[model samples]
Target: MLKKEQFLSYSAGAIVAGMYCGKLELNGDFFAGYEYGTGISPSLDPYFRSEMKRLEKEAEGDLKSYCSLARLMFYKGNKPKPLVAPLLIDKP
Candidate 1:
């Protein structure tokens, strides 16, 4: 198991790397635009929005509550009238 600080550090690095990767890919595509003999349209807004939303969702949910394969299976099998992932099923 990783120490708390180390885990946090790695997580931050991963997020930063993902964001940086997206930017790099977009930049590379921009430079390679002439391959198709047409101007490439730059659109990073949606990508950035999706990344922000993903980060927000992760921040809002607790890892403990989101994890546990056994618990997830139990809830999946015994889900009320409408079956859904345990993580998404709202508690009364």
Candidate 2:
């Protein structure tokens, strides 16, 4: 028997996976965009900022940290650029 929050967490993860699966191939920045977009929001700025403060006092996972950091990385209305993937190197 799954708890309500646990079930919701799994469902949320699945939904996010589905939404970004295609974009993953299309844009290298897909994951970064998703992290920043979902984690940090103008609507939730106060909450996010507070959560960040709490996290700073007691650091949370990478997702929210990325968004909190994004605030410092970019100006309002300007999104930080996506991180590029390293090229594959064939072993000799």
Candidate 3:
């Protein structure tokens, strides 16, 4: 029985993941034509800025969901989930 806010937050995380993936795919071509190689165009800059803010909001929403889930599980006497590990680790 997840709360409405929890479900909405999960959906927001999916949307943010999709948005970032799409941005990464287009960045190369979209940025290739920009002047000074800074990848910022007069027309695209505003759109990019807005997208960044949206992404941040979505990420915050997801964090809230995770925290809520963690708290719920803790109160239920369940162990906390392990943190996700880094993809690459250096050997000593």
Give every collision pair in model 1: none
Q: What is the C-alpha RMSD of each candidate to the true structure, in Å?
A: 17.0, 15.1, 14.6
Write down the worst ten-residue block by lDDT for model 1: 81-90
TM-score of 1: 0.25
lDDT of 3 at 15: 32
Q: Candidate 1's residue-wise lDDT over 1-92, tens digit each?
A: 33333333323323333333222111233124322343322123344445456644553464333223213322323445212222112223
TM-score of 2: 0.25
Sort by lDDT, best first.
3, 1, 2
Off by over 4 Å in 1: 23-92
The true-versus-predicted C-alpha distance at residue 73 of model 2, in Å, is 31
Best by TM-score: 3
Select the stronger candidate by TM-score from 2 and 3.
Answer: 3
Per-residue lDDT of model 3, residues 1-92, tens digit only: 33333333333333344343222112222223332454334334454455556656755677655343333322222234312211111112
lDDT tens digits, residue span 1-92, model 2:
33333323322332232233221111224334544555532223454344435443432245454333333332122234322221111122
Off by over 4 Å in 2: 23-92
